[model samples]
Target: MDLQLQGKVAIVTGASKGIGFYTALQLVKEGAHVTICARGEKYLEVAAASIKQQTGADVLAVPADVTKEQDCQAVIEKTIAHYGKLDILVNNAGTAAAHPFEQVATALWQTDLDVKLFGAIHCAKYAIPHMKQAGGGSIVNITAVLAKTPPASSLPTTVSRAAGLALTKAMSNDLGAYNIRVNAVCIGLIRSDQIEKCWQAQAPQLSWEEYSEQVGQSIPLGRIGSTEEAANVITFLVSDAASYVTGTTVNIDGGAGSAL
Candidate 1:
């Protein structure tokens, strides 16, 4: 399918690696221009270069910490200065902050909210106007299945993601008149840099496939998801192909989540 995304402009946050990186790459492959942002300037630039090499498309690398409102604004401003408009925003910047409630300090909770929740808000606040000017656009929030089914020791991330779900719905209702759509994706255990770190520390003796197989045994689908799998749905959600999808979430959990 064409996706009708050629020449569209997009921004993907936390794109130095993992899902964010793959999503940005996929967008460029589909003929869309992408701006990828992250806190680490070095890695962010590397990611941009890799995307450009792979897709033969131009990609902007913005080193911004999404937790800061000013940085979020700068990202949008720079994007507009370069691309002239915005059509898609993927609020994918975040970190894993799950811990026992008693172990999580107040400071930790605040930081988690700042990055996962307010980060999305800040980006959306700046991106929405440009989207409205464009006459239509799509926004996809990257959340976790724990938002819908919180397990033990899932602290700030669960609460923050639940808030994200509410934000998605509310934004959708408000932006519908402007032809803007808002949605989210609830991710499950997926192969990512974070998971790679864990695997190296916890089970380095095993081959990568062996470790992944062991992890997959716990999931209903008998495997963990890949970054490309998650990115494919996100690309579609932000494309003209999913024009009617809004105020909703698609679970990419491989049947691991209990929520409908």
Candidate 2:
């Protein structure tokens, strides 16, 4: 299906690897000019090159820590300078910092909020004006199902993600008049760098497929989701194909979470 994204300009944060990388690649595949940013310059450039090679599209690599307001502004400014205008923004930079409430330190909580919550806010704060100026645009926040169905010991990640869901709704209401759509996707058990790290740390003897199968037993889908699966939803949400979608959350959890 045509996403109607050709010639659109987009920014996907934390695109160095994992879900963010695949989201940027998918946007490029849909014919959007994408600017991908991450804290690591080396990995960000590599991701950009890969997208260019795959889609033959112009990809911009920006090195920025979304936790920093200045860095977020820089990303928006650079994208505008390079692309002339903005059409989509995917606030995908985040860290999975979950721990028992009693064991979680104040500093860890602050750091988690800084990266996951404020990061999205900063990016959206900067992107909204440009989106308004360009007449209309779409913003997709990459959240987690834990936001709605918090499990035991899922501390700051769930809290921050819940805040993101709220942000998505609030922004959609405020920006609807400008034709800027705001929405979010709640991810669950997706194959990503963090999930791979868990496999390496907990069950090194098991092959990746074996580890994923064991992990997926509890999920209704009977398997872990791929990055592409997550990205496909995100690309659609940010495209004209979903022109009327806003102020909502799509759960990409394979029936793993209880929340609707």
Model 1, which residues run further than 4 Å from truth? none
For model 2, the local distance difference test gives 0.93
The top-ranked prediction according to lDDT is 1
Residue lDDT tens for model 1, 86-180:
99999999999988889999999999999999999999999999999999999999999999989999998999999999999999999999999
Q: Which candidate achieves the best TM-score against the true structure?
A: 1
Instruction: For residue 139, give model 2's deviation from the true position in Å.
Output: 0.4
Superposition-based RMSD of candidate 1 using all C-alpha atoms, in angstroms:
1.0
How big is the positional error of residue 199 in model 1, measured in Å on the Cα after superposition? 2.3
Candidate 2 per-residue C-alpha lDDT over 125-147 given as tens digits, one digit per residue, 9 for 90 to 100: 99989998999999999999999
The regions of model 2 sitting more than 4 angstroms off are: 201-207
lDDT of each: 0.95, 0.93
TM-score of each model, in listed order: 0.97, 0.96
> How high is the lDDT of residue 122 in model 1?
100
